[model samples]
Target: MLLQRRALLGATAVLAAPSLARAQAPSWAARYPELVFAIIPSENASGVTERYGPFVNYLSRRLGTRVTLRIANDYAAVIEGQRAGNIHIASYGPSSFARALMTGAQITAFAIETNLDGTKGYYSVFYVKADSPYQRVEGLRGKNLGLVDPNSTSGNNVPRFALNKMGINPEQFFGRVVYTGSHENAVIALGQGTVDMAANWWNDEQESNLLRMERKGMVRAADFRIIFKSDQIVNSPVAYLNTLPDELKAAIRTAVLEVHRADEAAFNRIYEGKQGPLEAVDNAAYEPIIELNRFVDNLRRRG
Candidate 1:
């Protein structure tokens, strides 16, 4: 009876071992040990740091979690970090968000940068030197057009989509196409006449870059023309890895939307204008972008 009882106890111990290990297993919070959010810097690192450091620290305090801000040198690195699960949350351009979702990241919230006629959406504007004689989209024919990046929604995808609507094949439409890697670089290329035209995301005509160029006398409202514009896309999204726990995910979603109300000034700088409060959203909201991508892909296939 003693031996039989011993065997039964041993079996029970073995049965309980897996549960014990699971109970002791590190949680998402434990494994990460902290929360990190990444932002892609269009400006120089120093400018970004000076502009956003205080805001980052404030978010850390509010969330009651250790928070670190990561400034990616370029857009791809930002998305790649999120895809690998090293970055917990990110502010992603619509195109970047699309790419992240394709690779399995989940979008939880999006910012509304402006109130255009009481609606929140932004568009990509195609810019050319103000002095250029090109008056319309068709004028871009046989002229070099600068594209910011292959993955850029405003810089690449929107222009291509706009071109398609104009019945022009983007690849064959421009005399030459160059990718400048960022919207800032694209603007520079256009200002310096390195390319005949470039695309960028903007809401207000009074944006800093537009004002700067006008002040420099390099380009003016009359100097450049928006050859094409695309439908309003929901602004950049704050995305998370699918691997994150639902509870933690819910918390992040709540914080992003509520943080604006908690600290308005910091939120304004981080968003780069009147990019006001965030709204709860999910990946499905970007179905239009996905469809646009597919249309572009199909055109490539047919061509």
Candidate 2:
């Protein structure tokens, strides 16, 4: 996704037609010369950096500042980083973002990721080995369950919510619940027989954690079957601190919104699949998820 500087620009002009030469440099940019951008490790650390490095470079050029990418070990680290005002910007799963705000992080969502279908939502699903005796959620009772992370939307929050909706309590229902630390690890655990089933995100047949692993030859898609899938959850978002100046927020928003148009290949590289244009969104978009987290939190409290 690297682009050489020349008469024709590739990702160099993601937000600026000429490296932000025309727009007035904001005071906030000078004060915060370098911005820390953290992301949850949906994949392994190196894989995450490889996937987002180009997009980070493009964002730096567009914002006329240095942007360092921090691949968090877990979702809580990202939420804490932003809460402490250390991470200037972050990419978050819906539930993690909601948790951040619920825990009193002063941030505002600027851009929402759109799926290839042009929808602003995805689903949480349960997966088991295709040959496993577990044919449904009921069959998985008394068997161990693998989850991505506690702060994860699809992997944690939504799965619990889905189970509770079905009158199932994860702790009592599953023989044991294990936190695999990531969607990748959850599926890996399933494949390795560390758990009977796992929870993850699925957006159509073409996009999912399973497909990504399958493409990398980590897991075969045919080896697993989805036993349950929750209702559509809000799409993930990229947000900035509320403390940032309005102009800086606008700059970040513009850069994100124009990413696909400014550099098709670079944008495509970030997703590694089909994607729709970015949508401008706000905190209101994730209120339901906050409630979902509240529900999950209460469940944890009772347990």
Candidate 3:
């Protein structure tokens, strides 16, 4: 009878082990009742909120926690917020994400956006007024230029790298360089004659900064002309703070990946796509930007 009892107890323990482990697992929902989601200010704050609010709400319902949307005023704000642990999750530009990682921020990129045809990249374009005499990047020499941000991949880093590769130094080549803070603002500055030429992003489907503004009647296509366009740069990333428990991390990843299926139209509108889906990405995917960052850093240090 003792031997039989011992065997039964061992079997019961084996059956209960998985459940015990699961029950002992840390619950982020319990510890973190509210999670802050920060987005890079690709556009104005109000515009960012209006576009990303529904997506945040969906994450809240899917993760079973209250998620607040934060439209950071600039790229650095989002990076600093994540570094300080105030922002739980962030949609980061590639260059900004590289900067965040280099700065020792505890975060991991989980997903990246795609174009309407499922391409996973976009371009940096240099533009001038439609009637401007600038026919090439060199033609814009000694003219005032507008850049989005130092941490912007398409708006700043790529353009700088491209010019450097072409044997041109942007700081010395342009008469004056202005950081417009946001892509839309950079375009607006060009329209308001604040800068003779501007650098911003251009999507594969032609649905990006300039297009968004045109849709809202802010600028017309004919208002600007693309003088230079850089090679494909990977789309932005959605990253979560690594401080979250493993279970919560998995939940957040699942929620984001499944969001498109939950509301395809809303997802498309948020991303300005018709049927593109988010795909898993990692640090390796951003190596190009990392290289570009190094080049830009060296260039700055030399100046």
The most accurate candidate by TM-score is 2
TM-score of each: 0.79, 0.91, 0.89
Clashing pairs in 2: none
Q: Give the whole-model CA lDDT for all candidates, comma-separated.
A: 0.66, 0.84, 0.80
Better of 1 and 2 by TM-score: 2
Judged by TM-score relative to the true structure, which candidate is superior, 1 or 3?
Answer: 3
- Decoy 2 TM-score against native: 0.91
Error of 1 at 237 (Å): 1.1
* Candidate 1 lDDT tens digits, 49-87: 656666666656554556677777666777667766777
Query: Which residue pairs clash within candidate 3?
Result: none
Q: List the residue pairs that clash in candidate 1.
A: 130-223, 130-224
lDDT sort, best first: 2, 3, 1
Tell me the tens digit of each residue's lDDT in model 2 across 187-219.
999999999999999998888889988988898
